[model samples]
Target: MTANRVLYLLGSAAPPVLNIAGVIERAQAADWDVCLGLTPTAARWLDDELPALEELTGHPVRSQYKLPREPDVWPPADVAVVAPATFNTINQWALGITDKFVVGFVAEAIGKGIPIVTMPCVNAAYVRHTQFDASIATLRVMGVHVLYGDGGFVPNEPGQGRPNGYPWHLALDAATSALTRRDAGRE
Candidate 1:
């Protein structure tokens, strides 16, 4: 199979970031060219990891607004995944507020009608918050896929039910399923 171009959007949450690098590695092995989108808040966790990501993906990580003087080369993304999406970022994107580079890219993707999957990493409290709920609802109405978060096995806790974490492999499956469904409808 040809490598699919996937854009990996990293949020500022801990568990999500914890698995991203490994996910990138897996994607690379599968021949997918992964593009990294790091939020400004996420940059705090990216010390040596940023360059390592570039090395792993063979494409520069795009976290800032400034592009190179000359047009830099990058593979067109086949799909985009925002793993560990923050409540603020999700709300902002859903409400059309692209204040930062990462959110801006996601906004542009939505505008262009590209395939986007957001795996949110939110506390149990915020997940039930009104604004968060509304934002996700608006996003779904606008055709964005929100991977439902749930903590498997555990009945209740803060940040319990997320589609990410140790079950990172499931993410690829979830993304594939969404893309397949989207493409099938188009056909």
Candidate 2:
């Protein structure tokens, strides 16, 4: 199969945000042309590394919506992974809320039949929110591969996330598997 264009959608959770370089390296090694879209707060968190990340991906890291007449700079995504998907982002995305650029792209990707794999990086405390479980269920019903709980992203205790334990590879693996499944169906 040809190399897939992967969009790495990042939210404002600390673990994956801090270790984004590993995510990029693994994706590139897997023959993916990766681009990044950061939620606004995530952009702020990774401000200093933005230039390096852009250089690594060879595409601008988008954090805001482009103007109506402006052409999109990044390649059209064949698959997307929303790693470090926060509680807020998950809920907003499921609800079709497009207040942020990342959420807007994800919502549109759903309609366009683009395969999306998401690994939520929320704490146990936040995971207990009533809307959180419902939102995840809704996204799953929409055909999104949500990596949470067993065999996926287990919820970390409040303030207990270890950067080393964040499952960036799992998200990438899921994205590749989803793409493979999608292509097989076509054949």
Candidate 3:
């Protein structure tokens, strides 16, 4: 576990984001103090379940930046996992665009030396876009553990996404490995 054991479990508006509750539960089972954050679209998708998610995590499900002078809602994170990271999120994050709360936090986290794990849920069609590969490479070069392609999330054909088959465990395992690596570096 990380020194803080605080996990910022951020998700984007992919189909896999719908099963986030179960992922949160699994993270909790691993003894992580999970803080949930969502992209705006993802937040809207889970609007009705936001309260329950907040209750489950014992922290707010923040999708927007807090106003200046407002107290921060979630605890500081020891590690961050961006699963089902949408195509937009991946590109924006790599380009240092932090308009959205979830992307903002993770982008800043990189400079703060917070270990991060991200798995993109982009469809094969979207992966063909020119920016996608560059973005993915940029993130990896920044020391983010990107679980993509083989040994991680492989994009399915467009319109053929299987929400349940997004390989949640790989992202969780990558998070665990990231924390472990951080701890080892300290020793």
State TM-scores per candidate.
Answer: 0.81, 0.95, 0.97
* Clashing residue pair totals per candidate (backbone < 3 A): 4, 0, 0
TM-score result, candidate 3: 0.97
Report per-prediction Cα RMSD to one decimal: 3.4, 1.8, 1.7
- Residue 148 CA displacement from its true place in model 3, Å: 0.3
Q: Which of candidates 1 and 2 reaches a greater lDDT?
A: 2
- The candidate maximizing lDDT is 3
Tens digits of lDDT, candidate 1, 1-187: 5566565544544456756778887867766677777787676577568787778777777767765685745666666777667778888888889877777777888777777777666676776778988998888887777775452111125646543534555556666766678689898
Residue pairs that clash (backbone atoms under 3 angstroms), model 2 = none
Q: In candidate 3, what residue range of length 10 has the lowest lDDT sum?
A: 1-10
Predictions ranked by lDDT, top down?
A: 3, 2, 1
What's the CA error at residue 74 for candidate 3, in Å? 1.4
Instruction: Tell me the TM-score of model 2.
Output: 0.95
Candidate 2 lDDT, 82-126, residue by residue in tens: 888989999999999999998988899999999999988888999
Over the full model, what C-alpha lDDT does candidate 3 score relative to the true structure? 0.94
lDDT of 2: 0.86
Alpha carbon lDDT of residue 72, candidate 2? 84
lDDT by residue for model 3 over 27-98, one digit each (tens)? Answer: 998989999999999999999999999998999999999999999887888899998899999999999999
Indicate the residue-level lDDT of 105 in model 3.
95
Task: Estimate every model's Cα lDDT from 0 to 1.
Answer: 0.69, 0.86, 0.94
